[model samples]
Target: MNDTGRQSRHLGIHIDRTVGEVYAYASDPANLPAWAHGLGGSMERVGDRWVAESSPMGRIEVAFVPRNELGVLDHHVTLPSGETVHNPVRVIADGAGSEVVFTVRRQPGTSDADFERDASAVAADLARLKEVLEFD
Candidate 1:
């Protein structure tokens, strides 16, 4: 059994937009910085994948999965000593509105402090998304 502690936060909102419209925007990695606060760079498409370079983190791969009821963003960030952290951003639609969940799984032997720090960042990202989608 996988016993690693995984931290997750779920944020839901009922926007005045359709599921398709919301999924379209959330599925595009290139539009991340537009809604993700403190994002300092652009997301580029490499072959069939996407990559983004953040302020504190270097380059990282961005994956997208679009479904009838959900959209998922998966990526890994490298830690100080070459270890990697897996972050999954999930978006689920419930009729008119959608729910965004951020799951950050700490690498084995990694400290809880690191997970907390990343969790804060994920929270900010979700807030930014809410502001943009609700306003537009």
Candidate 2:
């Protein structure tokens, strides 16, 4: 792909829970800290957005889409440098349980190392989500 072209990697995990259960829990920004360690361990609502003050990338503002029945939990994270990253996430039924998928896109000018790092982080986050939803 060209340097300016976007590349995405999908990281996912299977959680031993119903789609409704996973959707309800994952769709809430307040519950992010419990499993989304990549986004920080704490968050607070400020007006219409959720702010994470101690994220690995520093402070960031997160805005999630409105709740719906389609199991879409997409959100945008505004970095400290004012760049907003769109994170596409979904929950889908898999047999009696559910699967969660997170799409990580390589931004323009991102190096191969950084892109792989982002993929690793997403994998860890998905694993954490499964652990939280299944064992917690």
Candidate 3:
């Protein structure tokens, strides 16, 4: 009911790692299943693309932004239903560590509770990323 929480939300985590380091690990499509639980499966390379049989979305194709030092990890996911979602993600240096950010778009007509859950999932994903990188 509030305009502020109406359509989109940004969520992230701070990892105790350099921006380039975090960007390098997270930007690799092969690492998705390790941190992104919703996409839990070994994603294989198909030519220039990555395909995964996601836990919830069935088979999907993902395309990540070309590797860069600036920490951009944007990607697109094409679902079995033919719907494509652009995920805006980034890793930024914060003092000696880095911050990873993810944008969750609340699909039109999404309930507030559903949006909140989506944001929570993103936070958990980021936490997993932090755990994986910090423990290494």
Off by over 4 Å in 1: 1-16, 37-39, 66-69, 73-85
Better of 2 and 3 by TM-score: 2
All-Cα superposition RMSD per candidate: 3.5, 1.0, 2.1
Residue-level lDDT of model 1, residues 1-136, one tens digit each, is: 4544544444444445566666677767778878764444687778665666664466665555544454665555444456655667666676667776666565565566876776677677777777788886
Say which candidate scores most in lDDT: 2
TM-score to native of every candidate shown = 0.71, 0.96, 0.90
lDDT of 2 by residue, 1-136 (tens): 5764378888888899999999999988999998889889899999989999999999999999999898999999999999999999999889999999898999988888988988998898888888888988
Q: Could you tell which candidate, 1 or 2, scores higher by TM-score? A: 2
lDDT of 2: 0.91
Q: Which sections of candidate 3 miss by over 4 Å?
A: 1-6
lDDT of 3 by residue, 1-136 (tens): 6554347778878899999889888998899999998775789999888998765779988999899877889999888889888889989988999999899987666787888888898889999999999996
| Candidate structures ordered by TM-score, highest first | 2, 3, 1
Give the backbone clash total of model 3: 0
- State which candidate has the highest TM-score: 2
Instruction: Tell me which residue pairs clash in candidate 2.
Output: none
Better of 2 and 3 by lDDT: 2
